[model samples]
Target: MASCIQIEGLLQSYIDEEASVSERLLIEEHLKSCGACSERLALNRATAATLFEVWREDQLREDLTRRVMAHLPEMPPPTSVSAALRRQVVVEGQRTRRWLGAAARLMPVFTPVILIILAGLLWVAWPSYYNMGGDEVIGMVTYCDANPDATHYSQGQARRLHVRNPIMPDDHFETGEEERLMLSLAGPSHITLLGQAAVQVRAPRAIVVTRGDVFFDVFRDNRRFQVHTPDGTITALGTSFQVSASKAGTVVTVVKGEVLVDNETSFVRLHENAQTAFTATERPTVRQGIDTSPYLRTARAVRPDPDAERRFLTQFIRNATHTPAPTEQVFVVNTERRHVNALLLKWMPDPYTSGHAGYTVYVSDSAMAPVFKTTISPEIFQDKQNNMVRLEMPNDMRRHDTHVLHITVMSDQSSGPVETTFTEVAAIGEAS
Candidate 1:
């Protein structure tokens, strides 16, 4: 016999129709057998029913009255002023409006001064603050324990992007909706998927798929190696690869690397020389006889459009390869001279072949490596003529080097992953 306190815990489950059959039966049996419990349940149900009935009636009456009132003419607020005073008030209001308009125009001139003063005040009030010294900021100034000592690119010129995990159990996820999943990885690494996808931290760094397909582009210094799906699992030994998983099972074709497919019936190892397919109830099968060239051809045909793919691909390549163009620049010069207020990296045609196109942006230091990254939701793509991103320095963030940016642009349906990179340059005063 559960105590009343314990029974109360099940109340919400009961109301939500989520209680197990055994729990429901136990509750019903207890209500029938125990007089006090029965009375309490009856009273609670009756009260709920009564409240619902009353609320329904009240809402209905209010809606009817609102409809009736909507048909009636609206009356203006009553005023007691004499005709002369009313006319005077109107003239004074017009004069006030004109003054307000003049002040609004002058506000822009004063805004810069106010901002400078505030910055001065912050410096004066907190003079001891300086750039935080850590391996992240010092870059080659410190020892490279896990990374290479050789120069991958110029640290000062490249934009560093940090991409964080986008799918946590605490994160809001809707089923059947295409979501752009961004993750942080050392070096130039990215993952993008269509439909429902969730990432888990343990055991080969897994991402469980609720529905749809996913694509991963992994680079150097990354340890993550496995992707789990409903039909089968794809485990990477090393190198670059692309895999598509659905209800029909998983089709794994290596671009430049090797992977192991573990189906329930058999285990098959796929190397750079071969492609493999696996299903839930069947054994892993290798296709050694098929020509790899045709597969690549069909893949290109099924792949998202070249223009849509270039958006994300360009961002990553931009970060990975930063030989200053002889006569061209990617970012436009800032007119306001404010701290790089916003960085927008966009791609088009919904980033996919079957559905609408889209683009996403990330902020980091190493365009090739990102510590934290995510997609820009409610993003405006393709129509941005001017830089519209606004970033607040020190308040919104403190300027630090060794930070990296990785952007991944994805399509709506039947598309693949396109990744990009941008590096944040220290503002004029912060460049030491």
Candidate 2:
């Protein structure tokens, strides 16, 4: 009979089906005789099953990323374009000089007149050179989900786009289910599309996304990249992010660097590993962490960089413990006594804290003396990314006067109390 310690050492190998025939027989015989060992084996089996499922899921995700990135159009080195242009210019200049030399030999008197004409021609073609510079290829379709099914609409005609097709300004690409497209853009940016995504390429440096989820791996330079959505616009200096658009709302997740989400009602900035969801009606609600498994998987497909996973894990672990509670500068709307139904307070707490012991809202008629007090439950803060607490104002307390509201966080740790205060002026039809 195998001892527990011996069985423990072989458990993983046995679960993985990596044990030899003799080892398997021994483990099986031992498991049959000992109930505790059997139970332990059963638990190991369950854990193995769970791990296998997770591994399978990861494999599938990795496969999808691989296929998508493999299809991205190949981009040549950055110096290629300028080098080709310079070669062309040199060739043209040589031809012109040769022609001018022959004419000068034939008619020395008219040579000066020909020189003036040639100079004028060069000046006339200068704008064409300027326009050619603007014609820098921004993005190319490296892979299309289904070459026949995917359609590109440009210049009032819809046609199928194949691999190596350049995506130009005003070009609209739409994909169906089971169809994905990958784009290699300037700045060495990469974008992958999934699930009925429709993206329109805009001039200069912008993309308009009408639907679906798109992942971006953008390299930051001096230029700004922008994504226009139905609910709002996302602007990034240089970052890797994912934007998902649906009927419900738009969600932006920043994997690396930061981005600014702006709509008519609100403007919010999201940092690395942060996420935010925006709706047409509501304000942007910020969240702590973003699930970057899909993006990271796709990035690995684009370029198998071992450091990418290490960096992600490192940042994730650091965020869990090191991120401080966020302080917010908020503007209070509808502060009029008659219109103020509730005092809305929004904040973000440190996720590493054990638990919150509820909060107290102190409303004072004067800065020194408190007039009203409201205590809120910790339930108001639980599992909330953007913590919002709304306390109803008493009819008597809603006077046409300026009041100071103080909020303090109650926690188990002795790191000292976290508190913030804002002054609210209650005047009819006025907000301050």
Winning candidate number (lDDT): 2
Q: Give the TM-score of candidate 2.
A: 0.39
The C-alpha stretches of model 1 lying farther than 4 A from their native spots are 1-184, 194-204, 220-224, 289-432
**How much does each candidate deviate from the true structure in C-alpha RMSD?**
36.4, 40.7
For model 1, residues 128-238, the per-residue Cα lDDT tens digits are: 212323212111111111122221122232212112111122122121343333332223333444334333322214545434444454542346567776667777754
The per-residue C-alpha lDDT of model 2 at residue 117 equals 99
lDDT (tens digit, per residue) of candidate 2 on 1-432: 779889878888998899999999988988888888888888999998888888986674444777788899878668744887989989999999999888768896787888999999988866321332334545556555555543788645785676655556777887787677776554445677765888887753688888888877665457788999999999998677889888888999987778999987999999978999998667999997767655555533432122322222222222335333433333334332343445666543321122334455555443435546676565554333434666777776566354444333333222222222222322232243
How high is the CA lDDT of each candidate model?
0.45, 0.63
Kindly report which residue stretches of model 2 are placed more than 4 angstroms away from their true locations once superposed: 1-136, 298-432
Q: Which candidate is the best by TM-score?
A: 2
